[model samples]
Target: MRNILTFLQESNDTAGAAHLLKTSAAPVTGSSGLSGKEIFAQTCVACHSADGKGAFPGVPDFTDKNGRLSKPDSELFKHVMGGFQSPGSPMAMPPKGGNTSLTDTDIQNVIKYLHEEFGS
Candidate 1:
């Protein structure tokens, strides 16, 4: 509990998370690692916005429990990597959430960002 809160309060969780997401088992060129905040700005902020409220109609408020970190990491990865086509969403999540070039690590990093930003 104390540890969790301390971890959350630290600034690097987002960077750690993004680093986890961007790297692949095989190192690749042109790969740039980002912090959680950077990942959010580059990828999620467009739809989710800075305040964590979604900009699009179907986009959920990140501050809400139903948003990105609400699900398991694997599930979020699937939704982010494959794209969301669920009913009421109107918009597709797009492969890698529109970052088609993102590695699995990148997705994980973004998930980490979400967890840090929205999870309890």
Candidate 2:
């Protein structure tokens, strides 16, 4: 019975190895071991656009030569996590860029992506 169980486990491992070899999984990249560009597209592009250019009138264009990320990382992090709920601006940055589940590391990774794609 033990030998049978061992054989089954080995077979499962071999099948998994074969599947991994046959299938394609893009390697993780960028800071935080995630695709920052992909996360931005999924979470931020609604306001920041695919190229990090702000789409709405109130949203600040990240691609601008003078953008918010040019500020210190601390400032950017506060804005992203706490959100901007000031008066006169209809759209405030939702906490954690609206993904409340994102960790500080994830937010930092997004900031890194912004620096790479938009910052001077």
The candidate that achieves the highest TM-score relative to the unseen native structure: 1
Q: Estimate the overall C-alpha local distance difference test score of candidate 2.
A: 0.61
lDDT of each: 0.60, 0.61
Supply every candidate's count of residue pairs whose N, Cα or C atoms clash at under 3 angstroms.
6, 0
Per-residue error for 38 in candidate 1, Å, reads 0.7
- lDDT per residue for candidate 1 within 24-72, as digits (tens), equals 3222223248666676666665556678877556677778876556767
C-alpha TM-score for every candidate: 0.67, 0.66
Clashing pairs in model 2, backbone N/Cα/C closer than 3 A: none
Alpha carbon lDDT at 4, candidate 2: 19
> Could you report the Cα RMSD, in angstroms, for every candidate shown?
13.7, 15.3
Error of 2 at 25 (Å): 20
- Candidate 1 clashes: the total is 6
Least lDDT summed over 10 consecutive residues: which range in candidate 2? 1-10
